[model samples]
Target: MAGVLTGVVGALLTLLLHGAQHVVFGAGGHSFAQEVRLASPPRRLIGMTVAGAVIGLGWWQLRVRMRVIRVRDALGDPPVRLPLRSTTLDAIAQIIAVGAGASLGREGAPRQVAAAVAEVLCARLGLDDRHRRLLLGAAAGAGLAAVYNAPVAGVLFAAEVVLGTLDYIAVCAAALMSCIAVVVAWPVVGRDAVYHLGAHATAPNVWVWVVLAGPVCTVAGIGFNRLMEAARRGGPSRAIHLLPLRITAAMAAVGLVAMTLPGVTGNGKSVLEALVGRGGLPAGVLFALLVAKPLLTAACLRGGLTGGLITPSMATGGALGALVALGLGHDQGGLSMVVCAMVGAAAMLATTQHAPIMAGAFMLEVSQAPPTLWLPVALSVAGAWATPRLATGLKQL
Candidate 1:
């Protein structure tokens, strides 16, 4: 029942996101990135500026009145209750912000709303703390599964990240909820993989690049995490009276950048699609995005905005991987850009979240990659997961 309700909520949120995007950017039948690119400079600037102002005001009011309990915090030992009104409002604000060109992932909104639904259901049924925690984690993962149609990744996310355990019982519950949510969401969200990677047989030399690029991606992922942390810590106070103005100013700066590089606007999905697609951006442009996307994301975080970093992190890794492939001259033959991008994405995701199995599963499920690519992907994930620890050990030595 919780999964069903969460699935419905996820579908509704997905519709609202698309509606908001269409209304804000006049996207019509086009993707957000294309619309932004086609829009005039002034439109891009004003759209983002207005979005910032609106979210700034909405979040300011919400924060001033009620304490917003994050999804993770709500799964505490005693099981913190997620206030329905405040949490839903926060989720809506996040969706609208992302829809209007905020450089943040849309995944967080669904997760919050789904978890809130689970919390409310658990309370009414008088579920115990243990059951409640398990349900909450499962619902959060279900939300992700609904949005992305990746049940395996959702189960792994619940087990590894939310519940912080792979206990058999918890894993079973998560898997059931995730599968249910995905099925319920199929009508609205479609069953297609989020990013399409055409057929490409895994080549022998691809393993070589994966091995060479793993440590590099690991370092980049760690650095990206650190940068986001710094941004959050250094951002403006949420309680400040002039928060709307500050956020507006920061968003306006983002708008200025978007005037030329519109791909930097949304949650990095477009960037990822371009990276793995044929005739991808030039090496110089990929490198520019490798630097620009994270900085833009960090800026949004610093502007007191809240959203997920998952897609942005993946996109960054993809760009880095493409660059590495180019550097090694793998683009000439024996390696496809798609494989490199996926490997880099998995490696980076594993490093950032510190969950190699989940990361690998996520990339595979979301891309619908062939089974043969698993070997290189797993190798990359293992290398990425170990690199940071090795670096720390070396530092200690």
Candidate 2:
């Protein structure tokens, strides 16, 4: 029951996201980045500025009225009951912000909404705290599955990240919820992979390259995570009365940046797609994105924005991978740019999220990469996951 409701709400959230994008950026059938690229400079500037004003005022009002409990806090030991109304409103605001060119991921909104729905249902059913936690975690994962059509990744996310458990019962529940949500969402969201990759044979020596590159990607991922933490810490406080004006100015600055680099606007999906697609960006542009995307994303968070880091992290990783491929002379013919980017994405994602299996499954499910690439991806993810811990241990020693 929770799964079904979450799927429905998740699909509605997806529609709302698309509608917001269309309304904000005049995005007709194309991706958000493309629409931003196609828009006139004035339009880009005006659109983001207006969006920032509206979001700032709206969130200011909402935050002043009630304390918003994050999904993580709601899922704590006692399992606090989520306020459905506030959570739904928060989700809508997040969607609007992202649609209007915020450098944050849209996945967080659906997860929050789904968890709220599960909380409501648990109350009505009088479920125990344990059962409620399990259902809430599953629902959150199901929401991710619905949006991306990734059941396996959803299950892994629930078990590894949300619940922090690998118990057989929890895994089974997560799998069932994720599978149902994906099936339910197929009609509205489509069943195709979220990303399309061109046909490119894997380079024979890709494994060797991945083994060497994984640690580098992990270091980059660690840096990205620290930057985000710093941004969150330094962001404007809710007590500020001038939040709306401040946010508007910050978003305007983002618009100015987007005027030249439209790819930095959205959650970074289009950037990732471009990286893995045929005729990827030039080496210089890739390097620029590797530096700019994360910095811009961190800036948004510092400006009081709230959203997921998954896609942004993946995109940054893709840029790093592409750059590494170029540096290692694999871009010529040895390793395809597509494969290198995927390895980088997986490694970075694993490092940032601290979940190797989930990260690998997500990259594979979203890209529909062939099974032959699995071993190399696993090795890369393992290296990424282990490197930071080893470094920490060495420091302690």
Candidate 3:
């Protein structure tokens, strides 16, 4: 009874907090997009200056918790402190940075928030480790659900990535919390929808596309996937350490890239939306953005930017897929490619998180598009095929 009650309370708190998170996150995304696109010449320069400073400061402060904070190890590892305080502060700060035009996503930030909340509560209550772990998973599910309004995704995320497997009790609690979160986020983000719809088809028309989708996307993206592995496993490689100084030199080189192609520096939703029909810049500009966005994202992470790799993958996959679509089928091709990018987001994320069903489910819930759930399932599972091989660092299950 007590455990159930605690779980219920934790779930409710997560639901409520998620309401605030959604409104703030949506407003942040909306405002950040506008801030990026406005006519001001110095806007990006200012954003980067602020982002660089914030990242430097945030990382330094994070160092204090270094003794206690094992970011890479904490993937499925035990909690080191109370969950609520640390995760909530992290979430709030991350949302602020992302909303202000820093190229980070809200997904991982909320995981830390919800985990901290559950951990602290479980500790105070003297719950056993297993029960506390379950509670922690429930809280994570709720926060993720709130962000994307995807209940199944939330539950599966907790099970696959957080808990390493599903527990019947955990699933029930996650479901309840996820329901509360989706309901809470609806009014704040306005339940209209997040994804733009194109003409709905029953399935992919080409056997070739179907066969190619997995291989092409997997390959087109596998190098970046390797980059993520490199990023996670990187820092100082002794003899090879200063050699990466070449990357820093690459960063200073971007100062020139910025002179003409500034849009590549931050999150690329503005560019993604532009591909939808605005055509503010020519397709060539969009192509330049495709090249510049990924390189810069890698550069930023390599260059000391803070945050997850979700949005950067989304920017590249979406725009590149759109460009592919334009070449093959124009708008339809572009739209298909855009959908491909969305699938890539789920796929690449699945690779990183090692949670294909979870990632696929997340795609379904967060996207307003109808039941193309099969695509995500295929992409996610395929993307995760190498998880066992690639499961170094945070992905080691």
Q: Give the per-residue lDDT of model 3 (tens digit) for 47-90.
A: 44444455345544543453323232444565555445555554
Q: What is the C-alpha lDDT of each candidate?
A: 0.83, 0.84, 0.53
Better of 2 and 3 by TM-score: 2
Give me the runs in candidate 2 sitting further than 4 Å from their true place.
Answer: 77-79, 236-238, 330-335, 392-397
Instruction: Please list all clashing residue pairs in model 2, or write none if there are none.
Output: none
Residue 387 in candidate 3, Cα distance off native in Å:
11
Backbone clash count for every predicted candidate, in the order shown: 0, 0, 7
Cα deviation in Å at residue 311, candidate 2? 0.2
Best-performing candidate as measured by lDDT: 2
List the candidates' TM-scores in order: 0.95, 0.95, 0.73
Top candidate, metric TM-score: 2
Residues 1-397 of candidate 1: C-alpha lDDT, one tens digit per residue? 9789878988898888888777667865456667777778888899889878988998888878878888988787474688888999989988888888888888898899999999989889999999899999999889888988899999999999889998899999999999999999889988988887754545566678789667988778879999999999866564468778777876787788888777788788888777665445678778888888899899888888888888889889888877776776665222477778788888988988888999999988887877877887899999987887888999999
lDDT of 2 by residue, 182-202 (tens): 888777888887888875556
